[model samples]
Target: MTEVDPLALDLPVLASLAGSAADEFLLARLRADGHEHIRRSHGYVFQRLIAGAPTVTELGAALGVTQQAASKAVIELEQLGYVERSADAADSRIRRIALTDRGREVVQLGRRLRAELEQTLLATVDPADAAAARRVLVALLAASGGLEAIAGRSVPLPSD
Candidate 1:
């Protein structure tokens, strides 16, 4: 059996490295494709929109940003023609933000880029190890209740 050095390896180090690697991987792929205007934070918003939710203030609360900031981002994206703002169909007085064809294209492309990255990250691992990682990840997220909070509207994140 190989001896493991506990001092040389730690969870914190691995977690930090994993985050940095993921960020670098994403930005490298997306930025190369001329997606410099999209920020990492926009991923959350995109996913939320995909799930059929639309509202700048709600997105702001979930992202821990002010409504004004969220609205600004929406405006910029709208100007880029990726998103559209219109009167809510159900409520004429309220406004809703939706992904235009350009927005959906960006989201789909983002998904493909992320999937490719994930495949490379797990490429060398044994199938059993990969299955275990998936199970552990699911369990950890479920236990943490992070997704549950965000799954519904007006959920919150840590305020900056």
Candidate 2:
């Protein structure tokens, strides 16, 4: 095994580590809540749906995936009873996907767990240091043109 050097870590690497840790924590909590079918990738779709229903094409564009891929994911989510698809009122040709009540519950639970995790971490570090970390992270996010720009990238990046 190669010896790892913490001093070689860069911003992108550190950010990715933070994301993976958060995803692991969230998925573990979701499993405890009886959502064994859900996976980390689905979090991107869920975050988009939480705002309101969006057509598969819109979802695909936001995540930088093909419509077919988005449709496939949505189909699995529908089969699992987390989301539902309906014909768009203004355009019957377009199908809009929305979270079901069960889906909303799952999203809410994830949000609650995330907040709790943040609080717990904040407690572990010095208050000033934690505040500085938040500023740096937020500035990095803003530098990338904010969440909207970040979410438009291809697979594997969590939207929220």
Candidate 3:
């Protein structure tokens, strides 16, 4: 008879703990740095903007939300001076949303913080283990239709 480690069966729990640690770290640091208005929800917009400037409709599609809801969020973020909306150069009738200087700064800060957190966590494990874990995560993400699909909505896990 062979014994299996109980912890080995809790991949979801382990992943959640790892993610929560990074989220808490960013939330605390951002708040301390006087960015109290930003919320995790805002990250959706921020990430999309980082990929490319998108119209409200496009953002809505990407985020799996209605255009009105996406527009409301954009308006709020615009008021906070984190994002700016302008007429599309190629399409005067279309409005595109982009990150303002402040928004860009916040995004850069997040990137830096995330890198630092990764380094801190990886330091506790063997380099090979960390690399292997990353590869697995990448594979999982790819298998699931990539980040856009995963970001758009939450679905119940399939029952075995």
Best by TM-score: 2
Alpha-carbon deviation at 137 in model 1, angstroms: 2.9
Better of 2 and 3 by TM-score: 2
Candidate 2 local distance difference test against the native: 0.84
Query: What local lDDT score does residue 141 receive in model 3, on the 0 to 100 scale?
Result: 66
Give per-residue CA lDDT, model 2, range 1-160, as digits (tens): 9987866888767877888888998898899889988898788788778777889988887666888988999999999899999999999998899999989989889989999999999889999999998888877787766655556543344445
> What's the distance in Å from true for residue 95, model 3?
1.5
In angstroms, give how far residue 47 of model 1 lies from its true place. 1.6
lDDT of 3 at 145: 60
Q: lDDT at 9 for candidate 3? A: 62
Candidate 3 lDDT tens digits, 40-98 = 77887887888788999988877778899889999999989999999999999999999
lDDT of 2 at 111: 88
Candidate 2 TM-score to native: 0.83
Return model 3's CA RMSD, one decimal: 5.5
RMSD of each candidate?
Answer: 4.4, 3.4, 5.5
Candidate 1 runs further than 4 Å off:
1-7, 142-144, 150-160
TM-score per candidate: 0.77, 0.83, 0.80
